[model samples]
Target: MTTTHQERPLAVLVGVQLPGVDDVEHAADLAELGRLVQTLGFDVIATVSQRRGALAAAAVLGEGKLKELAELTGGSGVVPSGAPERKNKARARRAAESGEDDEDDALGGDDDEGDADGAGSRGARRATVVAVDHDISPSQARNLERATGAQVLDRAGVIIEIFHRHARSREAKLEVEIARLNYVAPRLRETGGGGDRQRGGIGGKGAGESALELDRRKIRDRIAELKQELAAIQREQSTRRALRQGQRRVALVGYTNAGKSSLMRALTGSEVLVADKLFATLDTTVRALHPEVRPRILISDTVGFIKKLPHDLVASFRSTLDEALEASLLLYVADASDPTFRDQLGVTRSVLSEIGASEVPSRLLLNKVDRLSEDERDALRLEFPEATLLSAKIPADVAALRESLIAHFEASMVEAELLLPYAKQSLIGEIYENARVLSEEYGDDGGRLAVRAHPAALDRLRSLLAR
Candidate 1:
């Protein structure tokens, strides 16, 4: 068998700047999209943006803007050779006008002319994909592909692609597939004019079904099957959840690549997979918080949320997010150094509300504080008085977070005195496992124990003694 390794596809990122939107924020959004494309294993050739009063329904960008973008991609719109220097000068002028340095190269790498994927040897490189930073409609995507002669992906499409690539566990894979199919079903098209396919079966009823309709049917059926499988998984997860009902749970919820996994590892003292890419951790990882305390606390790191996260993706991943819903506390982690961290925090809250975890007790975690200046840190403190600012890499910061968590759980504990008979000596071990034994006195019967424990555990001990 011959194994073929394909080169990374080149992509051109497009963003449309609209009225009433802050230019800096828009640029940051485009920069994040470029990062997402990089995470998706694409070599971004260029990042392009256009300012317009509003988005065009046909292609988001106007004809001239689209042509300008196509020129860079070596598409049919306009060849870059005609005004290559002019284009470069124009980009420089735009950068100057924005009061920012030539930052476009920061997206991926320097723009160079060459063949892409062995399409041409010496001509201008053709981008294999055009990634729009906005969530364009399916029709818009098709229009862009037709005009640019490349595969087109809107923001949601790119994010979903990243999810599909990063998903590892069975539940993550199933949920990602369901979300991908939902996105793909609407974009399916019939290449040939063959609507006259007749079938007598109930599934292919009404005298016929077009190729597009059949494809959509298959996607719907696949989605249903995946959902059914996910339901079974959810049941298993629920049972596991029930087993740990009395234990305190802290769920880390945050924007993608905001150091949630790093914080998880820091707090749990476990070998968690940490990456700087968006959506690096898809599966929920639960670990007992290290330096384990009485009435153990479990911390779970969940799939991160993003601005404009697909509704279907959220719906598909709801079961995985039940960890947050059932959590005793939620840590709203954010990159405190990022200028847009506040907005990212808002996005996280919105997703939490959508998942019915709005009422869950939440504490803002201003993570990655080491990247911020003292002035910036002061400003963040002023903005979010309740937020805990810490760098996951700092030992003292992680220790503070750990101690804060312990304090939170400790506040909920109840002190109780229990009497055990001599035959019930085995119960002493259970108490030591689940509670902080303050005092113990040996008696003729057995032992009198004074301990502070979670109310549920205290009740359980009382019941066990009665039995």
Candidate 2:
């Protein structure tokens, strides 16, 4: 018999020391896991991890450690100095039959062959689910599950869960569902490796009525349904894009929660939801800007980016992220207060490039400079010589933004004048709305007028020109 100090709702932070991810990132991943566990109503009282060589696989942890974790997660591991963690004495008795004796007493080591089934092996309420800090290959996930008595998932899966929690709109929900299904589909286990269907938990996991086959079928069907729904949504988005192409679209692109939404609201006076969380703005929001200052240059606020985003997920969200594709100009807003601002900038560019917006002309808008010291602000100006140093939260900076935008738009616009008869008052109205009016006047006969419009808006105003 043995006693184990068992903390309820504990999670094991597993890590595979892979290349391109340093120790700082490994720490960050663990922190993110803590946050997600909290969100899922689980308290992380401990983290168990092992480092292995770069070439080493097989979960990067040994089998003995796995067995130890399995016992604890299975509710047969030790607690305190001499007791089990099961609140239910009946459950504790149930666990004891599963060969949960102390390591010194349990057949000398982890290799002892003990064949015990059904009656007492399961003790933990939440079955052991393995969380890895790295990307897990499909085979890797399957293999990890076999090696450890738990369901396995990687960084992307946890992120998708957070996105699921934050998603609000139909479009956003569909996008998240599509991403989640895509991420999960390849990882779903077909074989009942742990035990059998009757021996597993729900979602075909941990051995219960919601068997592996049932879980696989649900995942596959959901994947099909989400694909169909996303395709339809993509078609609708395409239609809307055609209409918007008539306007010069400037998409505000940046890192997540870098005040892009706040900037959008400030510029267009549109009340978009602004929050402090990552990926707050999932949908692209377009706003009419510079009506009098610049013609046909509508501004859009798009979703933010993070480092090491899942490639398949990015590919799936390409349609929703069309702002980068359709954008005539990208206002790359960066947070001044971020310590890794340069690194984040690189990541943003990489993500944009992956989404096929590499050559798009971008204005580096260094936002939140109000939080910086004067010396720090000077250093930033030197770093980004062409970037507009401003605080999106400040009205003065908003004015500076407006000036920069007007300048950019005017630089792109081709000025042309068209003459219309006074009877074509409707055409004049079109000119006023679609083009920045330079001058308006009547002919000597007062039956005609002359107007100037930006070339970008001329296509949409063509029919009105006929009037």
- Over 112-151, each residue of candidate 2 has an lDDT whose tens digit, in order, gives 2221221124343444566666776776565556555566
Give the per-residue lDDT of model 1 (tens digit) for 139-163: 7787777678888899999999999
Off by over 4 Å in 2: 1-12, 19-51, 63-130, 138-152, 190-222, 290-297, 420-429, 440-452, 463-467
Q: Which pairs of residues collide in candidate 1?
A: none
Residue-level error in angstroms, candidate 2, position 234: 2.7
Alpha-carbon runs more than 4 Å astray in model 1: 1-7, 78-123, 200-206, 419-433, 439-448, 459-467
lDDT of each: 0.82, 0.66
Best by TM-score: 1
Q: Give per-model CA RMSD.
A: 7.0, 11.9
Model 2: lowest-lDDT 10 consecutive positions: 111-120
317, model 2: CA deviation in Å? 1.5
TM-score of 2: 0.71
lDDT of 2 at 191: 62
